[model samples]
Target chain A: MTKPLSTEVDALSARHPGVIDRPLTQRFLPFAVAFVLIAYVFGSLASFDVVRVLSGTRTDLVNLFFLDSYAYKVHAVRKLESPEFVLSLEGSRYAVYDERPAWLAVTGEETDIDLGSDGRVHIKGDTLEYYPKDEEVAYKIKFGPGLVPQLVEGVAPDWMRASDIQVDMRPSLFARIWITKSKIEIHRYFLGWENFWFDFDSPLNGKSFGEIASLAVSGERMDPAMANWQYIFFQFWNNQEWQHGEVYYALLQTVIMALVGTLVAGIIALPLAFAAAANINPVGVARFGIRRFFDFLRGIDTLIWSLIFIRAFGLGPLSGIFAIFFTDTGALGKLFSEAIENADRKQAEGIQATGASSIQKYRFGIFPQIMPVFISQLLYYMESNTRSATVIGALGAGGIGLKLLETMRTRQDWENTAYIIALIILVVIIMDNMSGWLRRKLIEGSN
Target chain B: MSAQVTLTQNPRLREIGDAYERLSRSRSLYTVLLIVVCAVIIIGGFMVADEANSGSFWGGLSSFFDYPADIITGTYAAGWGWFALVWSYLPFLVETINIAVLSTIIGFALGALLSFVASRNLVRNKLIVFCMRRVMDICRAFPELVIALVLVLSLGPTPLAAVIAVAFHTIGALAKLFSEVNENADMKPVDGLKSVGATWGQQMRFGVLPQVLPNFLSYGLLRLEINVRASAILGFVGAGGLGAELKKVVDWNYAADISAIIVLLVAAVIGIDYLSGWARRALIGKTGTI
Candidate 1:
């Protein structure tokens, strides 16, 4: 054994030069130029205007806190007049105001009245407040499109009454990307294109049904009046940088969560993984039980795990983290255990034959042999888990997935959705390159 | 000195002593940990499970009593807790199996092609291998759910989208596996092919693929089993399958169906495990190989 080891060392050294002598000019020069070109291009494209990106990101955070909806648009924002804005659409009526002290109450609360008997309507006290000192106070107005003459019937400030009732084209600049919403609806008060007494009436309209059977028969394309994708992209792209920047943040969050989950998984699983290896245990029962346990945990989708944990733990980063861990531990554990089991048993035997304890044998022999494989697995899982995190996050466990869902539901922000997803992909690409480089380093000699 | 001499002379006594010592030292800890894990999984799962709403545990057990009849008749109304009995639509359900098998086959076929180019041993062009491997990595790096979501949104959520999503993921997974297997194959045949002035294609066809078939089939079949379970959930995204029904049941607060679906899924998995084991053993027998 001692003679063989010395001879193996001599042979390896004789076959391969100790120093790397590949011509840098031939092998690396092109890569250098390509790297620079890519970096420059990405930097330029990503920055577009450095000043604007920086300012926009900062401006967005400020606007977001105040619940400002006009983050991107500057010209002709649909501002409420005199602190009160009232509108009636689709047989529904509501009043809106700036996010100020005085609050407005737009209610769909119903009160049945015998119209013929009531000569005059009795009003309740303080139905609406234009500018209440506290958030607790809100203005109350009684208005319905069902009453042909009026959709909004209340005494507001004279200037407010005269002001145009229009929705702000700009949602708040500081709007929370996932949660904040800006809605604009054209009410069908008087009815159609040829209809209505005032601006309260919408020129365009659509129908709805109470039941699914009735709905399918209505012959309405589910996403009727679907906007062009290019048009949607352009519209959102023009919005202030900071507001749109939240979408990137959301995407960043998705990638970060994925990485964190993967890291946490590797950190916790490494020790257990060592024990789980078949060679370490050698006992069939021990190996079978551990392997099966790992399988059960990793067998399901991260989303399913997320769903299970979400149900049990409720939605948040915590739930997502646990879900990621629960699955990743199983997966990484399997990979690591297999790697350990596959490592040259001779190395461990050599250490053990020296009368070393199991721990000592593992540390000196198995650990060194399997360390590279473990690192490779960890790197791959990190890249892989990033994709997983996005899906798992969609389980409402709080990450980019939540943001995407909210954006789609509220604004149908396809552009932002695209941006968020694009960012996740970018992060993954970077990780892929890094992992590839590492794997090359690890496997160079063996290959 | 006397004890050492006796131990050396009689190997049996020393072996028995070592076995006893190893067992006495480690057995208790392992048994305890295992028993604790089993207890938590078996008991805690039930304790936390929404069995009360799902029909009583006993009620769930009893429903399986009439599973065959119930599977056909059961819909939104006549659901059994333990037996999802979607067995009546076994044809539609088998379609899920078909999708799983077909997608796995298709994914790995394409992946195998890519893997041939990606393997370092086969391809001396570092750039090509890097690109191909990166492509596979990216493809597989994505979880099926994300792919499903993307495909659903773009393609208007068809079963075809689900199939494509599953296939792409399979490509990613199987490509990497195939590449690794390719790297590990015996080089003798490849060397022989090369000596005969065989083209790279001929070398792969005649030299390489035959040796790797069992490994590829094993991995592909294993993926198929995984995909069957995965595709089952694809329905949650409006893709076709039993998972769609599973989602519907969950949405409608049908606890019984949830339990029934889980049970069915577990059973399906066990069945696949048995089938995979048999196949692997048969292949091993033929090849005298792993």
Candidate 2:
């Protein structure tokens, strides 16, 4: 029975070769496409230096971005020539030194620093001494007329890196010191953003959260002119380093840009969509022209649009909004016209059979059919435009994107960059959920 | 007329009439309220944005076409040189396209793997699925520009930075889409293969891939279109591409040069859109017409 069946299958294949076997092109087309795609990808990646990126060196950069975005550095600089000591955070000059910090002390002719586990360092005029923790021998360097520091006593420990002009020492991950001929600088690292709540000038800068809370509740004022909570709020809002107030306002501008841009685009596109829709507008040329116009609008990238608008509007959220409006008009018009074209013909016919006027037919017949699609599409674009607004803002349209670009340009304010990024993501996610919920409600409601 | 009088007199008919009126009224009321709320938000938001903007809306509106007019005049004056300018910028256009292509390829491969893990129908472990979904979410949440900008800081404004950033984002987007596609797939083939002593990988490769490959390819082609736009935009933020060239001309106020780049970019985008749209339709519309 099996042999007979096999012979029958062979006969069938012989009778209908096309049905049993695929053509050579069909068999090899996918493989050919895959080969081309792979070749293009690899060629491009090689040309773009993917190897250098995938190499171990980039991990350092990745770590730097991750670490610097979360941590703040405090620097202590003592100018040898002027003989003055200043401690600052994140290399800012706004150091308040009415009195010395506990870790650093200065007497008449000498300065001493407690370098945590690396032991203490005592510096006298023209003489530098390092006392290694848990060790008796102290390494000493005497600063003289020459750039080099003459080793006065003891063997140099591993922590000491003495060069011609500068003596550098890194005791731990959190602390380092650079003693040069011109100045002695010590950097101590700490987790989290420093002066995030208040600037160095604010009296409340060094206070912990618990301390600030107590200060707020104790009926005592951190600032003599205001209540404690008000002072804290003022300091936080007016934080010199972070600028929480300005950042929040920029975020608000971004949100508003998306909202206004999307709504305005929808409004402007509604009539144009009707003109462009084949079934709604009987004139072929007008419909074709309008369709092409929509295409032209969408074809120009939003970045280019914003750049053009920036020149006219002079770098602000308005330009960003206009860019979004223009680009989205083309997009929404295309989408809306398609929705209009796909509207049920039976509904329009039913309305027309009632002896309704054209305007009334459109109002009662077409509008209801496309309303759900129009609304859901609008909401979806609104959410997406929030992201586009951000990108536009970076191109000099005033919003969080511009603010982010500003922080990023500085290169040192990774913490602020991180903060802004987090906020943008949070807002985007919120917008996403909000638009989803609205789409569900509107679509269901329409039915 | 007597039936109408009877309808008015009957308690049940009266109750139903009143209930219908109340329901319709409430529905219309909700609609009116929604419209009012939306109007207020839009109007108020416009005012706030306008106030925050450096230029007033009315003032900007008056001069909205000035820049475009300038660019047009500049391009016209340049005459035949504008074509040369476009020709010169073609390489930058190619670079931008390359960035998109490489990133999309990388994204497609990674996203396919991630989507498999993320799909509830394919993956038995709920925890793994949950974690993978969250991973995609976080990846998607980060805008490409943010990542590209940061990477450029570390990597020194290379196309690789843009590629990685865009590819990272594409992974999340494609995975989400692919997983949704995965959920709707038939399980009989998978079960049959599994019963035949096929390995898990074998079962997925033989039973599921053939079913979902077309949709995956279609979605991937769609992503390629998006990524092309994305990579061009990323170039504006110092990633290497036509956008970077446009940024240069824009900064220098070279109107003719800017228009040339804009033309190239628009042409490229539209051409890609058309090509990809056709390809996608073919892929989905015809089963054997590779």
Q: Evaluated with DockQ, which candidate comes out highest?
A: 2
Q: What tens-digit string does per-residue lDDT give for candidate 1 at A74-136?
A: 111112112223322212323121232211132243211111211111123212112222333
TM-score of chain A of 2: 0.83
The TM-scores, one per candidate, come to 0.51, 0.89
Q: Candidate 1, which segments miss by more than 4 Å at Cα?
A: A1-245, A267-291, A339-357, A405-412, A440-447, B1-81, B84-95, B116-147, B154-156, B176-204, B269-290
Q: Model 1: per-residue lDDT, tens digit, B95-131? A: 5565576577679779999999999999999999999
The DockQ figures for the candidates are 0.03, 0.63
| Candidate 2: stretches off by over 4 Å | A1-30, A49-65, A79-86, A97-147, A150-161, A171-173, A214-228, A355-357, A445-447, B1-7, B286-290
RMSD of each: 21.6, 3.9
Q: What C-alpha lDDT does candidate 1 achieve relative to the native structure? A: 0.58
CA lDDT of A207 in candidate 2? 80
